[model samples]
Target: MEQITFSQLKKNLKKDTTGFKEIKLAVLGNCATQLLSHALRGYAYELKIALNVFDADYDQLEPQTLDPNSELFTFEPNYILIQLCSEKFQLEFCDLSPEEQESFADRVMARIQEYWRRVEARTKAPILQFDFIEIDDGVFGNFGLKTQKSFLYQIRKLNMLFSEAASKDKQVFPIALNSLSAQVGRDTFFDPQLFYIAKMPIQVDFLPQIAKRVFDTVEALVGHFRKCAVLDLDNTLWGGVVGDDGMEGIRIGELKDGKIYSDLQRYFKALRNRGILLAVCSKNEYDAAIRPFREHPEMVLREDDFVMFVANWEDKASNIRRIRETLNIGMDSIVFIDDNPFERNAVRSQIADLTVPELPPEPEKYLDFLRKSNLFETVSVSGEDAKRTQQYREEAQRTESAATFASYDEYLQSLEMVAEAKPFDSFHFARIAQLTQRSNQFNLRTIRYTESDIKSISEDDHFITLYFTLKDKFGDHGLISVVVLEKRDNGTLFINEFLMSCRVLKRGMEEFIINKIVNTAKENGFTLVEGEYIKTQKNAMVANLYTQHGFTDRGNGIFHADPNTYIFTPNFIQEN
Candidate 1:
């Protein structure tokens, strides 16, 4: 594969920019940025995202970032990428004494912190700051690693300072250009000719890579990350078919060329540890496929690692559909990996939204393919994510048990469910923000909030925020529901946003939540409680939610109910 050249990207800038997710980006830098903007838009289009870039003037990042009346503030971008030109620091570093270098670095750090605070106060957009690439003063050589007096030492110290500060900020995320440059050698990453001629520090060949990093970060912020890894058996898991080769003949474990399969299994297990759900979709006899997982001594993934194992001779597309149904997740949230091109093409043709990466013919390159492709980019992590595999495994058991019950209502009653509701705390703030960003089908209002926005709501006195956790005879479904109520001046409590996880649907939890809202309104001495159902392409299932729950439609997406006239009854869910 060849690198995308500057001439090609410039020629393709005016192509159609429709039919993709529109992302607004503001680029403020101390160098020329026109070419970078074109490259970013070009690469983003390939990833099914359309970028609208707002590039500031050359070397005016300070004025643009700090001034209230600047166009940067007016653009209201979803992200602000601040690229600090290395030239701005090179001259100062060459002249300062060892004591003066400390004071100078401190001043730079202070200025950066002040700039971040000013921008954050004005807008809710996240800040992405670029870390510095190495610049050698040529006098100290290897001694720069030990002495703070060296310019390279001071620059490294500044990078450390930036990272420490960003670690604590929920809204600030640093782009590690130092590490990126190291990966792609600095000689190839920077072009001195372009820097002197056009004031562009980054090379043309490196544009696509940097642009991908930027787009991946944006994709994560808007909740486009893949959640599940669907696997294939036979040649994919082992060397040959289990039905034909048998347990002793098939190549896995200690056999020749079998270590690659073991390495792949360890890789998948690592993904499972980081909250990616694993499942098997194979075409073999159920018992034959179960032999390796149950009896094989060298198997890295046990029967419990996978939430669902669909081992039959069904078509690959049909098995994938059943997996989607059982998991209760959107089709776009799956990443299907198969060793056979026929199976991969079949799934791709049937399901246009699913991501199916083409695997190499050899088994050794499987890990390399996964490492290079940023298919599972994420920006945040929580305790709930770590326990996701166990949670889904419990759900599978619950599904199997439901078959024994005569009716759906009988099954719901037998679970002995208990829901614990609480206000927003530090532990659950990240997960709540994540839910709001990702929950589309069941979300009312469809308003996306960042962690900082949620924190502000918790601190504000006019809003009441609560999250619900559900536990049944099966197991704990962590933090499944969120509700935000705003206190209005006319003694009406307005539901700002309400959403729930789709896994817990059709279980009478909705009725219990509405009853809880009504009771809270009565306790607060409010006259009327109102709710809304804004229509979106994905949220049509929730359009008539308020109407079904006994709220009169006041027109224009508004529904209101008088708290005194509302009659509430106990349901299957017991509130704690």
Candidate 2:
């Protein structure tokens, strides 16, 4: 089979990111061609994967280049690929007597095996092992039946070697073919279609395809993931500024100039559907900026579509900082998209790691640019993503209502919040773990666990994981909080983990959940509700939650909240 073409290689490499610490590659020379070498170099850029390519030649030649630190080893690669080419070559030959032929074969084969073992010992990085094309007489010329049989035998041996390597621990098989029908004479034996369909290994048919796959794989591996997409109001989501054009005069809807902005809004809607968190960071009067969202006829995105909105006349960077703080996500996880270049640059300068895309002046290219960037390609999404925007909108309304009350307790009472706590089952395990990993500000313990851990907890009756979905007059905050409690023998509810989405903070959600836990403990004949506060860089907001709930500081980052002393009353609505 021929090597993959350049275009196909590029396409495949763009599939993901490569941040792997160590990578091993085995190269077999079919001809005196450097095409594979050039391809490897190009792929390194696309995948961002650091690989040490070992080049081994089947035919002996004088050593031209050698570097102890270089990833490429020519002699060793040649021996390994040649030894695996035929069964006539014995593994014992690697330790045979020093006859001229035996010594040459033994030296090459032994060095390859030794180098591979040594490198494997040196690092824990994943290895991608490749087998060079094993060309025989039947592949090169119009050979008779015997020649074709021999050729098939060589190919079978190569396939076996690839299969064996793949079976080894942490070894990846990357099958690369130059073309679909490059060797037409040998088409009967080498079925390219079968290889592609069976997926025997991660195959790259052409150069462009290989490049693209490498890029994609490396991008995913890097894990430089971004979460929130912060948008600017006026000339961003819609065409014109609400302050200048008024609600009706804004360039939005099906009108001639409005279609572009309307389409842009639809694009954001699609992103939201895919679980990309949306927030607004604008320097406009809150009322004016929100007017179109509340009243515009053709607007697809409403106030409920944003997880957070900083619509005051604050500096753009400051507004972004506030959103980041409110959401409790890293600034690096945020992508600030604004129409104004100045605002974008300002955010880029102020927030060291924040991603600010250069906005195209023409409205038609905005969607295309974002699609090409692929900045929001996350690994997985949980139910929390879908409900996050609505939860934040509810939070904004709650904050506004809270201002009218004189005290925090009075405001919480006016809302009449009820937190329905149910034990986590299979349906909520993934979401629970996701909340634990993502929630920051109100996460008391901030101990992130995987889905498997959550599943294990569900299996054990001692562990009670409950998620709280809060709803009141404002709106429904779907699955806003989760608390994991472990029941001890002494009838005390030990809060193993507690996390509330930043969107639901300051809304009595935490207090309400704590009250529910206490009530559950009292009903179960438990004596006390205990919890711990683990110090983290991000969870300072929740460090004092135990104290607020009448939990006495018990030293060593532990607290004991007295159930009898806890007094929680809903002001706006009654418990269900």
Candidate 3:
């Protein structure tokens, strides 16, 4: 395989935003070998990953070069890539007698294995490590008639050893095989056994593609999150401004230019379906902008498709602020998309954290632009994504109703708030887990549990996993909040895990849940409701949730809410 230059590999690594933490490579050759060394250095610079290049060419070094008393082998790397070639293999038998060759090879293997064992023991600082085996013509030249069989046996043995080692060490040991010569073929000299031995192919021409696949695989194994794209209406949803062009005049249909806008809408809809929160921020009359969505025949997006809508002449920055505040998400989590460059630039300038993509002049390029921006690329989508828009819409309605109420209690009363808390089952486990993962603000413990972990909680009687669906006069906010409660033996209800969707924050959802907990505790004869405020980078909004709900601080990061002092409106349940 042709080798990649250090500069080229570095450039690609820098561009690789695939979110891999570390790159560990093992080179089994002269440490000074320019190509591999350069590639390793480049990767370190580009990916910002810790590079661990192992010098495997023991034969090339002077005898007893890495003495046990020396410091050559003391340094440890996050990843260890072993470049195993015939040249390095010769080092094992260089000073050995004919009868000692087998013993020497065994001893060498044992040492390498032991080193890996130590590396695996240090798992607190996990490292991505791999080995690269180079197939060169020297192996065939040295073994001559037995070259094929010997090479096959060695490869198989090495694979088995690595696989066993990986399982024992709990470290990923991927072996990348590179065939330098083109003379070998499957029918002529190639061995099917090699297929099982090699984990990744070393193709010269498709190195970039291969690297990208590896990066993607690693990211999928880990997980990644990016900003959500908040779309706009009028020229954004279709081709023309709905307020000026009227519903029928908006270019969105199956014909010519209209098809382009339709396609763009379809693209946006697909993105929405994949958990990207779709919100409309159009500078037009509410009814006028929403009319095309309701009455237009060619419209792909409906009124229910959006999470939030800001249809007014107010500054878009203000509307965006409202959306962010209501959602309880940071300004950085949003991406504003508008057809007008001025609007896009305005939001971009005002909200430095908000990501605003340049609007394409032609509708046909909308999808392409979105793809290139990579704003919504993620590892997985939880069920919470599907109902995100509905949740936001419900919050918007709650905000509107709050304006009409005289006092906070009156607003809470008017909400007709119903907090439908249910034990998490298979149907909602995924969403519950997702909320734990993505929800930042309003998260109590900020303990991110996976779906499987949540599912396993059912077996424990002391642990309670419950999710809440809030609905009022405006709409049903599907699965707005989740609370995983743990029962302690001291007659206390411990708030183990608590998270609320950004859409439902400040809508009396938390208050309603607290009231329910208090009532439940009172009925069940519990003394106090205890909670903890686990600090996180994003959940400062709810740092005082327990205190706000009348929880008294009990030092050492613990708070207690008195069940007796809690006041509840008798009609809270009847109204819902």
Candidate 4:
């Protein structure tokens, strides 16, 4: 997220956004929010998203939230943003008694959580709450942290309490303005003069980047985020090429400038630990590229660390395309990192959708530059994420094993794939919510659900929700699919949502799921099973999904089938 000048953002307000994806957002702030609202909408245009922010009237947060019939709810926003400035918070804290200040963090949290619950009670829109940035009045000086009644103590405690609250309630997302303030100097992050004059807390010069950060979180929540990082080996991963430098000559560890590369590896390792897949795309012989990972004692990344390793003389672009195809992810969901400008430009030019970061000339600066860029921000992480690399490695094995079989059906049958479908449970709510937000190409209406939404649907008698998982000889594809059916009064079951991980495509998982849907409808005494295919930019793969599952197209994007007469689709997958 590059910084945009005040004028640049104002000019962006006039750009065309006719076809961009529109997201309804409700903004409630304690200070003037008109500029922030405009900056967000305009910055979103750069990302090809039309952010429709509905800024509430000045200082009307409590009244608008307390009133159920207010315009806030009437707008029906998909997201709700509440920004309460530190400037306001400091003033409020100063007015408190010493006894009251002792519980300042708790008191503030209770109030903030009230807003969250009130918003959730009125609407299911995800709440984005801005946490207070750091502020010290030098009242207690260095001892403020030890003193519970100090502003420094309460402010830090409040941020932690806010994080814990957000963790317990998945509907709440805390935006870290404090972290941003720390990164850019506080002098740049806040404007005392602007606050006094126009009631705007943040500096105009920093609004563009701040707006971009907000949108980044929004993008991740809406199922648009990077999943993989493609790294170039030479100076990118180590100091020199393994082919030319040989095993003993390459610099990777703490002998000299090699510490830089090691630091970079550690950062990438942290990313991998949180569920991002790592892959190698180097221009060297497979043996030479594999040697360092296999034999180098100084190397932090082993051969097993990467899910996909493509080392050949082929053009980097072609290699990247092959990697994308194997992973079953869009090109946009990848970040290509290389120390060589030629390689970065070559790959970026060919793949317009891929993210390529510009590394500083100095190797030491690479990690900071990439970290500051925030290329891999995600809203949630599940246990399934940490095991992602292993799962993909298993997938590669499955693909290689398939080539040995004479027939595709025989290959699938040999794998002994078993699928388990169950009602939505709290244990899998995180993964289920993630699937709804992440799965795109296979999603049939493309409706995203938060964990709170999943919890509600699980208990709602009017809806039938099923979470599906597939396991085979290779490994378990954890929570691969989700199906939500809305029970209708007329003995018909409407398929409200049908989505699955694209990695499990062409494995008869679709057929297995459809058969179960039909059986479930019949068991529940639903005579008719109704569905629809809503076309999206990425979901054309499932445009004819209903028709393929023995559903008769009823025109206008609707389809129907008689559950009593529905024949199960043929597939080798067995129910567990």
Candidate 5:
């Protein structure tokens, strides 16, 4: 792949971004960031985001944040990106006394946090804090890492403190420039000549990578990210074809160069543990495809690890479509990995918007390539994420069991589905916020919220929030739905936000939720319940959702229901 030069990205500044989503970003830093400002915008243009940047003047990181009426506040950024270079910071560290130096990390964090507090107090935008890159001054050489006062130790310590601060405050998301510098050798990442000539810490050659990392987080925050990894079984997961290479013949554990596959498997398992779904797609016989996962001692990913497994002789593209449909996720939100160039291209040609990386022929580079691609970047993970595979497995079982019953309603009743719908609490704030961001297809109004927003909504008297959790004879669907009802001055209870996870769709959850909403409106003495369906490329599934729930479409996406006349929709779900 050809490198996207900073100059190349600069050319995109003039490109018309008419239809792109407008995402305001305020970039503030201590160093000269004029070039970086354009580079970020350019990269955003490439990603179909109209990134309106409020690039602050050089070294104005704090004053702009501290002032309540500053242009930074006026910009009203969706994200605030700060890049404080080590060149300026390390000089400040050198001026401090030995005692101050030892505690320099803590002192710096105190000031950094003050900036965060000032910005957050002014606006609800999430701050994207770019961490310090390495400064290999080589005074103490390798010993500097162990010395607390050393610039090497202090900078790394400062980065750790940034992470610690971000963990405590959900609004602060630290971008790992330190890791990026380390990945592409520090010398290649930073140019001493460039820093001395201009206050640029990062080389122009590396600015695109920095911009990409920032936008990766931005994309994820805006509810656009890959959620699943659809992998080929032969050679991609294992080393060779499991159909031809028998169970013992496959190169997985003890075979020559099998450690490569083993290491990659460990990484995939870690990904699954973190909430990303895994699906298997192979053009082999069903028995041959699944035998390794079930019987092979060397296999790290078991049959249960996959949410869906398609092992048919169909074209890989058709199989991937089935997997995407079964999962009910956008085709773009999946990453397909195959060792064969033909298979990868075949899928790429057939499936628009799908991500299919041309894997290296060399087996050893496969894991590193995918890691560097950063294919599955996501914003938040809840306890529900870790159990996603199991939940999907249960859904498959329910599907199978439904086939035995005569009617769908009878099947739903047989499961004895129970749901808990109640006001939002502090305990589920993270999950509630996550659903607002990730639940795309069923979302009405498509409004996104952060954890801080969720907390604020829960405490606001003008808003009524409800989060739903479903459990049945099969398994629990943890916190699948969120409704934010805003009390309006027009004698109506407005459905400000309505979204549910697609996994729980068509299971009477919508009926159950609508019933709850109408009842709440009646109890609150609001006769009119207003709703809307703002259409999107992916949310067509909910275009007529209001009409289906007995709400009259008043045209132009506006919907309304009279609570006094609202008939309770029949549902199999029992409110527990």
Candidate 6:
């Protein structure tokens, strides 16, 4: 792949906008960031995400953050990239004694915590903080790991502190600058001449790579990250076809050719643990395809690991569609990996939105390419993520049960549905933020919020934030719906955001929540409730949500409902 040159990026920035989905991104750093803005915009165009880059004044992060009326807040950025210069950051603490360095690191973390607290309190946008660059000490070369006071050791410790801070604070996302530097070779990535002349620490050549990393995070933040990875079985997952070669003939164990396949299975299993749905879409007999997983002792993945195992003599495109429908996700959310070029092209032709990566002819390059490609980037993960496979399996079971029932309503009722509505708390914060970032189709108003934003709303007296969790006879659907009601006045309430997971659609969940809204309004002194539905290309399914839920359409997608006139009953959903 040809890297985007700085000159090319500058030239591309002059082109007219293609009008992709717009995202406000602010870049703030001690190092020169003008080049990064152009490079990010150039790369983001490929992802169909229009990057509206706001280049903050060089080294003005403190002033921009401390001043409430600063341009950083005024710009209303969706993501703020804070790149910490290695020289500026490491020079202060590198010369200190071991004990002093520990104290200094704590103080630095405290300062960062304060900065985050102030910024988070002011804005809802999440901060993308870049960790310190790796700078080795000349004097303490080999002993740097043992010497805590050395520049190399202190910088490493600082990175750890940054990671810890980010883990605790949901709004702070740490970017591994050192890791990127290591990947591209430190000597090539750092430009000392440019650093002295233009105050640009990252080389002009590396700016594009840096920009790509930032955009990948932005992509994940806006919910473009893929959720499912569909794998082929025959030559893709193993050495040979199980049906033709038999279970004994298939290469999948500790042998030379089979070891790489086992390694690939391990990689997919790890992805499954991270909540990416693993699936099998193969052209073979079901029994033959599954026998390896069931009987092969060296196989790293078991039959239970995959959420959907589609083993049949069917077109790859159709099988992929079945996987998508079974998983209840968009076609774009599924990634199909196959060794056969014909199958890949066929699937790509049928599902235009599907991500069919061009596999390397060699299996050794598979894991590295997939990892570096950043197809499954994620901003956050919750406990519910680990249970994704089981959740989908339960959804599949529900689908099967729906077929057995005579009517849809009968199937819904027979499941004995229940919903628990509550305000956002520590336990529910992560999931609520995930839904805000992930939900697209059933989302009304199309507003995205970070965990800090949800926290602020939950604590504010004027906002009524509610998260609803659905449960049926099959299993529990954890924290699937979020409704944020802003009290405009004593007499009226405005729906600031109303988003629900698409998995709970057509289950009377909407009606159940509407009833809760009415009951809550009556309990309080509010007499009128209004809602606004902002149309996005993906959210057309919910364009008529407000009108359907008893809200009067007042021109231009605005809706108003009088609480007294609203009639709702919790007939199907048992409120908990």
lDDT of 2 by residue, 1-576 (tens): 123466554454444445643445454432321334346645665445554555555322123122434333422331122112221232233344536332343344344445445544433232333343444434335442233234443344545555564444322323333222123223443444644453212223333443433333333333336778999978888887789888887888776588888888898988887677899888888999888888888998987788886798778888888888776677867899998988877778888878888868887788877765556754335766776666666666677777888998777676766667788877777677667656666778876655556677878989877877877767776777888889998778899988887766666566667778888777777888889999876678777878877788999989986666667634333445
- Worst 10-residue stretch by lDDT in candidate 4? 1-10
lDDT of 5 by residue, 428-461 (tens): 9888988888888999888989999999999999
| Residues 233-293, model 6: lDDT tens digits | 9888888879999988888876669987888888899999988899999999999999989
Report the Cα RMSD per candidate.
Answer: 2.8, 13.8, 11.4, 1.4, 1.2, 2.5
Off by over 4 Å in 2: 1-227, 233-235, 238-263, 275-277, 282-314, 322-330, 359-365, 377-384, 487-493, 515-530, 547-555, 560-576
Q: Put down candidate 4 lDDT per residue, 1-576, tens digits, no spaces.
A: 235676787888898889888889999999999998988888878888877878998888888889999999999998898888877888999999999999999999999889888888999888888878878867999999899989999988988998898999988887767888888888877888998999998888878777777877898899999999999999889998789989778889965689988989989898998999999999999998899899989999888889999999999999999999999999989999999988888887888999988888888889988987889988888889998998999999999999999999999999999999999999989998888888889999999888888898999999998988999998998889999999998999999989999889999999988888889999999999999888888999999988988899999899999989998889989899
The residue-level lDDT of candidate 3 at 407 comes to 90
Q: Against the unseen true structure, what C-alpha lDDT does each candidate score?
A: 0.84, 0.62, 0.61, 0.89, 0.89, 0.84
Candidate 3 per-residue C-alpha lDDT over 1-576 given as tens digits, one digit per residue, 9 for 90 to 100: 123443578565345444544544433333223344445545454435544545444333222123433222344433344434433454444556655553443454566666555544442222233342433324455563343334333543554565566554434434333221232332322333432343212322333333432343333223334445677776667777777777777788964478877877888788777767777787889988888788888888887888777799999999989877766677766888888888887887888878777756876778776654445544335666766666666676767767887797788677776768777887886677667766777788877665546776755788766678877777776776787778889898888888887666666677777777777677767788888998866778888878777788888679987677776634343323
Put the candidates in lDDT order, highest first. Answer: 4, 5, 1, 6, 2, 3
Higher-ranked by TM-score: 2 or 4: 4
The lDDT of model 5 is 0.89
| Candidate 1 accuracy as lDDT | 0.84
lDDT by residue (210-280, candidate 1, tens digit) is: 77777777777876778899999888878888899898777777898788888889988888888888999
Show model 3 residue runs off by greater than 4 Å. Answer: 1-228, 232-235, 240-249, 273-275, 283-291, 311-315, 339-343, 358-362, 372-374, 377-385, 486-494, 506-508, 515-530, 561-571, 574-576
Q: What is the lDDT of candidate 6?
A: 0.84
| Per-prediction TM-score | 0.92, 0.56, 0.59, 0.97, 0.98, 0.93
Candidate 3 lDDT (Cα, whole model)?
0.61
Candidates 2 and 6: which is better by TM-score?
6
Candidates 1 and 3: which is better by lDDT? 1
Scanning candidate 5 in windows of ten residues, the lowest lDDT window is 1-10
Q: Can you list the residue pairs that collide in candidate 5?
A: none
